[model samples]
Target chain A: MVIFGIDLVLLISALMISATPVLLAAIGEAVVEKSGVLNLGVEGMMITGAVIGFIFAVNTQTPIYGFICAAIAGALLSVMFAVLTQYIMSNQVATGLGLTMVGLGLSALIGKPYEGIKSPTLSKIEIPILSDIPVLGPMIFSHDAIVYFSVILVATVAFVISKTRIGLVLRAVGENQEAAHALGYKVVRIRFLAIMFGGATAGIGGAYISLARVPQWTEGMTAGAGWIALALVVFASWKPWRVLLGAYLFGGITVLQLNLQAIGVAIPVEILSMSPYLVTIVVLVGISLFGHHTAPGSLARPFHASQ
Target chain B: MKFKSVLSGVLLAFGFGTVAFAADVKVGFVYVGPVGDYGWTYEHNEGRLAVEEHFGDRVETIYQESVAYGADAERVINTMAMQGADLIFTTSFGYMDPTISAAKKFPNVKFEHATGFKLADNVSTYSGRFYEGRAIQGHIAGKMTKTNKIGYIGSYPIPEVVRGINSAYLHAKKVNPDVEFNIIWIYTWFDPAKEADAAKALIDQGADVILQHTDSTAPQAAAQQAGNVISFGQASDMADYKPFPRVSSIIDDWAPYYIARTQAVLDGTWESTATWDGIGPGMVSIGEITDAVPADVKAEALAMRDAIANGTYHPFTGPIKKQDGSDWLAAGETADDGTLLGMKFYVEGLTGKVPE
Candidate 1:
């Protein structure tokens, strides 16, 4: 069925695929920021994950194993950021930037051998009856496992952050690290774990591009996706559900702009290409003016055990 | 006595290293996209490999991939020159200014910029006439398109890309009068997700044939996933999707040019020149026309390829009109190199203005 000269089913399917990577990265970053640590090396960890995941998937001939290694690779790179920021008390922003550069270089080196090589693709899951439905069925019920996992991840994160006792401690550390430490909470340990979680998710996000989206390893394939994911965290205002909404919104605009051109809209193509970034800036400004900011209190601040 | 002997050996090794470095010609490449793109940059890197294979111990080649094209390109080119690279290939249109500027600074090093028009004493520009291949693709697309609607995913609105669009449209229109061209410029050289999304959008809008200037296999993948769509490869032969969506390709065969230029550098005969060769010079070769196309259409396409190669046919043969109804080329008149080199206006019948 075509609506406004666009196939509704195909548009939604493409939207989900395009948004999944950013959504995963943003949600992971949201969790990291909520734990009083701001790891700005999502791009670095993601590229690292992309290369490592691609290599493993190619060698093992298993897409799932590749994802596991990608997550591990991301976490391992974050450990470097964690050590510098948490243990050595380095500046989070500078160190995170360094990590990103390092990740880009490292991934390029590792991915050199795997260039132009295709990886094992993940097969889409189609529900026998549901997938046969008119419009909504193909769009919603039929997708690869990762798509469903992303939605489930959002819900799981929302529940944990709002209701669970562990979530309270994590939020407490972010709100007031010193106070949380005085109250006998293991602030450093909790923050370390949160950073690792962020790294793992970002890794999976990167891997998604290589293993599913493009299904091939290319040097710098993540492009600026890590940076986009980083921006998405702020756009979400530290909420998991909002991250999904923002990612899909960006994806929708990206897809819609192309559709507009396909339907022969006379607007210049440059303007259409710039629409997503322009909308992002406008939305960010709108959020600042109307939406209440929910940033962690100790967002970029270093925590010290002594005084 | 033993220590003195060891010191003499070390001095001998150091002397040999300097001699080897001075003797071997070092060639450097700066790529706008990654070598893994399997498209434009990948083909250039293959040329680089060809240089290494041809000269063996006489030459050394190194490349920096995924380099951004503006100030960063200037820095990378300068570094290559400073590091004693005798010849450097700045492979992208956006690297034109940087290549020229770097050429001014490093007079001794020869630089070649691809798909650009600027040239200096130390910097030569070279590009393939890809429009010739595009014309063949247009023929096949026009003949085989079930919807008579062809969707194009353009990278940027540069003259080179604009030229390809016009050539394809002209040929498509010749075969099928009802053929309509829908162009979507995503403004990126390589972004699989964006390319795929663009392909999907075009398919959704009743475009059964897809053509792309962007460097990725994603569009072919998208077309294959959608089923029954016809597409052609750009820059390189995407053989992985052969016989179906990717019916054929416009291959940029830079190996011969790269080798010839490198040989000239070795011979000290290299000079600044603007080379815009097409099939006649063998710079652009049409890839295999697969079985996906009908036999009659494939034969016609191959004949067109041979005619273009043998100089019997020019893709931009005249009697053309601009989009504004102005005369671009009169009857039996061909487009001059100068106008084609800096093409800005669209030919008659194509919709929309060229983006500034």
Candidate 2:
């Protein structure tokens, strides 16, 4: 029984660690969606960041700089989708999907020489006395800087969206781009900036996986984490705090399922293994039932000047 | 006018006197997973490195990782041929048909598909008999498990994975008839999170011993976290987490085959042929048994290993029965390559069907 208690604590810690990547990705995606540009290629962006980050970290022996490079790479890749959907007036969903395929192929090509090599890992940041506080310290405060950054990002995004003028303008653009444009706002510019911001965050999130979480880059390491982030945007009802909540909830489910198995609970392994996906589906269904808010009015709908 | 005629004469002479560039031997590799996966593909890449190191000046190698098994494989191989690949190695069972089709298209190029039996004159096959190692691990699992129920985390329901599960089960049941095997097909080869979940699920089902064919450290980590549970490393020397696993492992050593094949290419003796080596040829190696295993069990495992190496004892010998109580092999008759290659069902003790 005592072992089970310890297992729960360890499970929670694992959940927090797993949640960092998703939180980083979801937050970046939230900002993108909030600015009225739908980049469904978050998975592609993340994987691109993962390979580039891994290669750079391996070559430079500095994981931090690798993350920076990853962010830049992600933003650059996002530019293709930005150009296609924004300038070329292509369908957002199709363009994003195409971007994903391109990102996957390009990463596979560039990542050839880097196969099987381990990259530098990010160092954990312990908050001195806070890290010594029994189970809570190791579970929360003892994570790497990126994990802390994700938490801070949640607070900062919430604050920015609720309190700042830029937030209002961004919201205005998302809600009704034509109205925002009519009101002397540069709607396209705002959305582009927001899209870049999302790309940068997604890149960092990917770097976190390669540099910290798994601490190695494998093909498709993101493994649909980007899709999860996309789902999280809807799960959170397009709200910042809710996105954090949703990411943690999913993260917790993932960790808890593993923990339950670790503790030697008497259940069918297949059932236990399938629980996380089941929980995700159930939560999504529950959210859809109760949370009835529509998506951003300008979401996925390109705003051409002619229109 | 004389200067123009002289220039023209010089251009014509130079054109006629042009020297031909020597063509490099073009080698291509198709990987099932990203090369960065520190297991199967990683080992294969190491072999590629060995090839490069041996014939650096004469051979040029190009490879694509994370290639799928279907139509995409055909496209990648065609693309490589178009790009001037003379010999291509498609390293996955699913790559069999694609390699065959591509071989037909590119008759000038040699194609080697791993773990597959389908052959064209230009398309050959190669794989290690990993079931030998699993037999030893199954013996250990039979000895070590406090609970008679053992869990297996399988990748895809292919013959390769099926062979491992059957071998492990056969050995386990030989030691302890009460042993029951439960399998969880994760349907993926390298998702750590999924693998971890699968390991955990096995533990939840009261399985004190676990074995996996997936490519990741997640299973080992999950087994470690489970404290009393034990597991063997898949596709690599994962003895790093020893004592907990404690007994045996099946390590894939692709370096020798890769080096030999590349040397053959460099020496102009390279031929398309199926190559499958077991423990005898050093293709399959067992990691050091940890101190945690009981001495008697260790001795038994070593004896079995020696028997396998010396070919005195066959792991899949006669008198084995299928799940339906049908005799799989007659007494004193070793299971032949045809039966083993097409093995699709479990021997009586397993509790699950081969997932379709």
Candidate 3:
């Protein structure tokens, strides 16, 4: 079936790929913000992950190893931000911005040698019976493993954040770190672990761009995707499920715009290009009107044990 | 802030002092995208390298890549001017206004912008006539394709890109009356993922031959993966995909122009002027036509290329009509540079409006 001259199956497929990376990065950032840490370096962490992930995948001939290295590289880079903001009590916003700069610069330096080199791409995991299902199979089950992993990761994060003992402690710390500390929870340590998780997930997101999406490494390939993920977190109102919806919404509009252009739409290309951001802003505004626009209590505030 | 400004003042003084010393000429380049893109910026970076190789120590060239083309571009250009750059090349269309403003700030520093119309006393606007190459590509795409449908992934609705789409469509329709052009305007200069997705969408709609204006090899790669498809490279020669999908490419050769401009600065012959060179002047080049193309088609394409080079043919010749069916070019009357430079409408027989 075709809608507005765009084929339904192809549109769904395009939406899945476009939304995967942004979803991965946003879900990771949602966790970071949930821990009372506002790490603005998601862009940085994602790009570094993309380069390192490409290098390893190309060398090891396996995307699994590449994603592992990407996560490690992203986590290591986030550690620097963690030390500055968590321990040294530097400004989170400034440090996060600096981390992004360092990430972009360092990734450019590291990725310089990998230019023009083609890395192996990840193939989709198709289940025989399920894949044969009309419409949904090709749209859902036909994507690479990372697409499934991102959804599962979001579900797992949502479950762990709401149902687990650790979830309670993380929520307590994010609500009021001093109170969590009084309850014998190590606020800084928990926040540190949360930040590292964010870095790793963001790395995987970046690796997804290099290893599967475009399946090649180019400098700054993340291309402001990290920023979009950051916005998605706020747009999702820090909920994992909401993050998934928001990412798909973003991906859908992006894919739809391209399809609209291909189908000979007479609207200006600039208007179509702005449709994704425009719809996103409108949705965010609608959510705000519904009074769900609140951030973590200590989102960007540095906590000191004695103070 | 006071201390920083004081320090900058001192540095500015020193920068001027170094310029006065003048033992070597320092040329700076501000690129809108990363040099690793293997497309527009990559070719410009190559031109910068050519400058270094040609002049050695007599000229020192430096560049900052991936600069955004708005306020950030203005600031970057200003910083380069303040750092005592003898001549700076701001290589992107969006850098036009910033380059002019920066040139106004530093009257001593010469500036050159790519694919822009605006110029100042110290600023020159230059671009390649890439449509000449597109005409050849159109001929090839017309001759090719078991599916009679060709796809074009446009970067923006700018006149330059519009000219290319028009040239390709006009020439393709000339060779094959049944051919159809599917154009997708992707409003970005260098996003590979978006470019690739556009390519896939086009191919899904039965486009067997693809053309792109964006700076990425992703579309070529997409065409390769989709087998039985043909594509052409843009900005740089992506010969890696040769013998199949990447049959030929439009190469942006900026080295000779760069070297000559630098030489002009050295000899005190530098003056702000507009330059729009094509295949004839070697600014726009067509990469190797591989054996994948049938001998007759290849010969015809090369002949068209040579004709453009020798000024025997024009891409936007008369007998063209606007998308509205209004007369744009009368038969046998070629388009002048002014109309082509400010082109904002699609030609007749092409679908969709060129977005304002």
Candidate 4:
């Protein structure tokens, strides 16, 4: 049950919980990148989602409704990025960065009234029959609805991106927008939808933190997790499944390191503290490198149908 | 209206506006966390607000919040200096070196860095003796833990945090010799999610009492979710979660000190100084001990609080050994200010070395 002073079951459970937010954010970002749009405002949108979701949760006393509103809030903020980059034809990098700044400032203003307020929490759903198993059940089958939702999201995104007709058009648009346009595919429209999806998931991710993880509202509480999700997207090489891997790996190490420290295993706190980021990036980057996964060709490129 | 505007502009050009501006003292504040954190930075901001309220138009305060540590801190300090700030307060331990470096370049501009030991001719250090509070929390945690495991969420390995750890451990060990401390160095002062996770890990590991040295009520939230676990608030009165998870709190009262320091500046008597104040001076006050704590334990904790405030009992009194079991203080001898300020080792009973 315990190895190296760490309870494996508790450690994995914590990993699942911690990884959900980043998994949601990265998976959404992977889709946006696949459509050749790099909306760099994940931090902004996520925080906006965190505060909005927290506000809704506090008001409605229902975690589910808070999540829905949080997703909508994230997507709505992303629409700002979508407009400037897609319709007005502004630079995607600059526009995304601006969105992040806007999101941070806006969320701080909106969350002022909600500070120190406890949010309604999402209870864990232990799957029947499977949750009865000895070690595996408690570790994997027992988690909140959002945790399972995150895994299913990765699977669904993977299925849609690789095995569906929609996936092919998305790839075509990201690889070469002009070619996709010449072939009568709606490049801008497809990218817009992808940006919205990314925003929605990011919103859910932020909501998860406020509603479940910390279950309290504090300004800048998302605290750069959005930025970490942004990094995971690139490291995963625009793959939905790899995003899950990177998030779990990052979360797992983070929890493991803390547990190890708690149990009095001194492994150089500096190295241990940084191991989550270093190990996750190394392993994810290694997989992407060996797997020959490159980013979408038109990533961060503004598409103009007029040449 | 144009003629009236011209007449007013001409009157203002006659040095009336300039006369008022000459008396204005520009003060700057640099915060390590969002001012809305409702903890460390929030309390510091309360002090800044007090300065504004006390002086009104004679003093103008501008603050830059959420400034990152290290190189980012240097740039923020430089910007404040370039903006003609007469006095700047860098309110975080991580801003130590940056504050010192900035003070050197802007010698005329006074600097105050919190919870750091480094000083220059122009740069001063000031901090609350929060360890005095940790000692009380330690007593409650030690006596109340059914599991006998006390979980600590430490932000960094700085002397201030280290002092708190030692003071808490010594007090806890005194009350209950079987008590065990599970210390987690989170390396961050204000990350809510990590703070929550650390609290959960401690709880899952059978820790019934949690004490956080970090900002935010996430740990208290985590403790509340776990049902049986109890926690103490740090740097602020997190009274929202009272009577259960948040049994008590260490409220950082910085308003009085802020007023005193600002007055010193206005009186043309401002000098580089180091201030390490505690409950005696009201810089660190314990919040109401809730019903969760036993009546006897609560009374004892308050007695200790009074003893500490009146200088009869020092938290770091003698008969203590270092983490390595070496002599740190002899019987009846209190720890000197210099050793406490530069504390880098744990006390005798606390497990694990202080991470530098």
lDDT of each: 0.89, 0.81, 0.90, 0.91
Write candidate 2's Cα lDDT for B143-242 as tens digits: 8888998988888788889999999998998999898776777667777656766676677667889898987766776676667888887777665566
Q: DockQ each candidate and list the results.
A: 0.56, 0.20, 0.63, 0.75
Question: Between prediction 1 and prediction 2, which has the larger DockQ?
Answer: 1
TM-score of each model, in listed order = 0.91, 0.73, 0.95, 0.96
> Where is model 4 more than 4 Å wrong at Cα?
B1-23
Q: Assess the local accuracy of residue B348 in candidate 4 as a C-alpha lDDT between 0 and 100.
A: 86
For candidate 2, give the docking quality class from DockQ: incorrect
Candidate 4, residues B1-356, lDDT tens digits: the string is: 99999998999887786675754688899999999888899999999999999998888889999999999999999999998888899999999999998888899898988888887888888999999999998899899999999999999998889999899989999999999999999989999999999999888888999999998888988999999999998999988889888999999998898877778788889888989999999999999999989999999999999999999999999999998889989999999999999899999888888886
Best by TM-score: 4
Best candidate, lDDT:
4
What CAPRI grade goes to candidate 4? medium
List, residue by residue over A116-188, the lDDT tens digit for candidate 3.
6777878889968888899878877787888889999999999999999998899889988888989999999
**Cα deviation in Å at residue B317, candidate 4?**
0.8
In the range A1-307, model 2's lDDT, one tens digit per residue, is 1365335555666677788777888898898898888899998998899889889999999988898899999999888888788788899999888877887778777887765455666777999999998878876788878888889999999889879999999999999999998898988788888888888888888888767666655667787788888988988878888899888888887666555544445666567557767877787788888877678888888987667
* Candidate 4 colliding pairs: none
The candidate that wins on DockQ is 4
Q: List the candidate 1 regions with Cα displacement exceeding 4 Å.
A: A1-3, A51-69, A83-85, A88-91, A101-137, A303-307, B1-16
Q: In candidate 1, how many Å is residue B309 off?
A: 1.1
